[model samples]
Target: MKFRILLLFAVAFLLLTTTRLRVHAQSGKSAARPNIIFIFSDDHAYQAIGAYGNKFAKTPNIDRIAKEGALLNNNLVTNSICGPSRATLLTGKYSHTNGYKRNDRTRFDTNQTLFPETLRQSGYQTAWIGKMHLNSLPKGFDYWNILPGQGNYYNPDFISQPNDTTRYKGYVSDIITKFSTDWLDKRDNSKPFFLIVGHKATHREWLPDLQDLGAYDNVNFPLPSTFYDDYKGREAAKQQDMTIEKTMRLKQDLKVDADYDKDWTYNRFDPEQKKVFKAYYDKISKEPAEKKLTGKALTEWKYQRYLKDYLSTANSLDRNIGKLLDYLDKSGLAKNTVVIYASDQGFYMGEHGWFDKRFIYEESLKTPFVIRYPGVIKPGSKVDDLVLNIDWAPTVLNIAGVKIPSDIQGKSFFPLLNGTKATAKVPWRKEAYYHYYEFPEPHHVFPHFGIRTDRYKLAYFYNGADSWELYDLKTDPTEIANIYGSKGSEAITADLKVKLKQLMNQYQDKEALQILAGAKK
Candidate 1:
């Protein structure tokens, strides 16, 4: 009887020891894998963020991320459109490779490998909340609640798994923030998570929340210096229909003489919401008709109205960001979480008389990127190296210590943030590739593919028009002067063309190569 009692005690002690060891191992693993929150907004330009030098822009939350971590100044995109840019971000590949080139009639090819799937397979909880512009439903996320196609700003409908959609009352930005925090609260405590907080603010036909309406009314935005670009040597610029003078509709864009009841966007608002919205816009709508403004005066008026509405809409987006940051801090997740802020792509805020973003020009090419990883990234560090949207997926994977797939075209810039002695010596890319395919439909901007080096840009407009444009970015930062065939510029132009062809080959862009060959002929 004494021997049996001693044996039982020994077994119980062994079991307890093993349990503690297992728990300790699990806790260590969780500590190694930090949570990632990617806040991606639509059409938010780099120039509009306060950290990027927009004095009047009220983006304190986004600015806080910059102050705390790194701001990537030269972050560009593979394609400068909505759906395609999102696809590139997910796959870490270009639009052509992902088979999602244009926003219309394009379904994301889910058969291809996605970074989220990699993360999930590696034991991370993955979820996406808010605007997912991809036509198809999400595939790899453990949980997803997304807006239905360019989601309405008011009383938006959200689609969850198994084809369930529920209408939620409140502004879209606020609703997204609520859903994001709610998910974080309910996520599995044992595993680290990756969440994409997508926002649909500041898109076309900008509509602000009731509180944010007329927020920027008093400040008259100055017109861009190139607002009246004559399209001197740029054929594509001449052909685009995104100009403020002709393309902007006073009634639709500026809310001048708007039919709120009949318009679909305004109809989404409840009676009280509509009343408040109408009260503010009604004051501005009367002026255009009363003054009989036309031509340049009318165009400038439209530009001011556009800026006000766009910035006002952005106010809600910024506020929601603050909400997320506060949640991280309050919940004790800030220390072990990586927070990143970026836009789908850059938008033109009256730059070169354009409003939409389809050009490979400077304004449209560069998007805003700010990241905060508490202990890893130094506060107020700025990365001026060339980084593309495609690199986003690989970078996130690297942050979580997951292996980036070899098929992904983008190289991770994780070394730029990790500050490890080994990774600090790793080299970064010197150039970026860009392609814009949606054309002659919504914006009349021709299809083009280009390469941007540190100090030069070379683009070839194809399909509707065949032309080559080259700009020495050092001398012509605005890209107003094209010196493709200039006498003294021949050597630099030839070198850029060679580099462009090499980039096309590197990316396996067969279509671009064929177009380049045709141009040569």
Candidate 2:
């Protein structure tokens, strides 16, 4: 009886050891799956980032992503507006295909297959922790904490799952970072994770943190070369209502006073928030009065204030980004994680004397995109291929080793990170298509669509005006001259039209087709 008891105990110990070894192997396999963290911000212009050659704006943390990996030089957005651009990133499809064309309060179709949904199904935990701006509860995320539309900078409210909202007491950027790091601490370690840290900083009506007040007081930004463009030869440029001089108001935008005008932005602030804001702006308001500025000088003053406040907000954004990066490094997650720093769309940083975006101009059209994927991508790489916001979804999915759906319009650029070709038979896209549908409200930019090639860009503003504008980007890099009907440009224009029509057909843009039909050849 004693010998039989000893044999039973030995068998039990051997089985327990074998089970432990098997579980350890499975956990190691899970770790092999790359984790993805997409850090998206609002209205973050490429030119403002330190890596993109901006001496005025200080963005060391954002630059770190580019330093560690690749920076996409030609990253363009299909629609250069907020909501539509986010929709494009989620669906890997353009505005027309995704059914979210304009930011005129359109609801996103949640039933559509998002890349997050695919990632979740493939044994990954997904979360979105900040400004989603999609006007609806996010779908396909296992965890979601989002801000309401154009979320406030001070004491923002976060919308969690099942339509629950809780106001968090802090600056929006810091709060977002806190929530993101908290999520990382609690995530299931057995599965790979995909998280989106969306930031509302640097958006319109730019508000800086209390500590960042007067951050750019000592600096003076030079006026853009096209500050007094006069809109000669370009009808669309003349018609736009986004000029900094006329559109950006001193009281409303510059925060001179809470009750200076009927602007609705100040109403969102609480009494305590108002007190703090008043103390800061009122002290700075003396400069404008002392200068006794008017006309051009006044315009320059507004421009300076605009840059100051904008960069101040950006300062907080970069600081929060550093916090997240530090957490990743300390936690040992940075090795297997792919970190992407991008914006919904680029903003106008006093380029062309404008404060808002919507044009297919270079300032608004090209978004800032930098990614750091260890082991897969080499450090300090720069990709100049024409990439669009639509490519974000497929690329992330591809990195996770998940099969991309057939309906996704974007071709995964995962191979590009490694200097390899995409598995697709067709060559990488040489031209990028752009379309902007917002008009007659907000900034009053007209609806337009265009195609940009390696050396030229062709835009057709066809909502109210039937006109065409073309630029040879190589010679006219600033796009000051509209050479559409200029001599010796007939052949180039003709070729571009053919390419435009092909893109429209490929994307199934029926509305653009109807407009193209009525356009002058």
TM-score of each: 0.93, 0.92
Q: Write the per-residue lDDT of candidate 1 for residues 1-521, one digit (tens) a residue.
A: 99999999999999998887665343222346789999999999999889999988999999999999999999998889999999998999998899999989778888899999999999999999999989899988999999989999999999999889999999999999999999999999899999999999879889999998889988989888899989998888999889888988888888877788898877788888888888888899888778899778888998888888999999999999999999999999999999999999999999899897978998889999999988678899888889999999999988787889999999888777656424346777777888889978898899999999899998999986788999988988988999888889888888888888899999999999988998942
Q: Which stretches of candidate 2 lie over 4 Å from their true place?
A: 1-31, 260-264, 267-275, 422-426
| Model 2 TM-score (2 dp) | 0.92
Candidate-wise lDDT, in order: 0.89, 0.88
By TM-score, who's the top model here?
1
> What are the per-residue Cα lDDT tens digits for candidate 2 across 109-146?
98887999999999999999999998888999999999
Best candidate, lDDT: 1
CA-RMSD of model 1:
5.1
Which window of ten consecutive residues has the lowest lDDT sum in model 1? 23-32
Model 2 RMSD vs true structure: 5.8
Model 1, position 390, has a per-residue lDDT of 90
Clashes of each: 0, 0
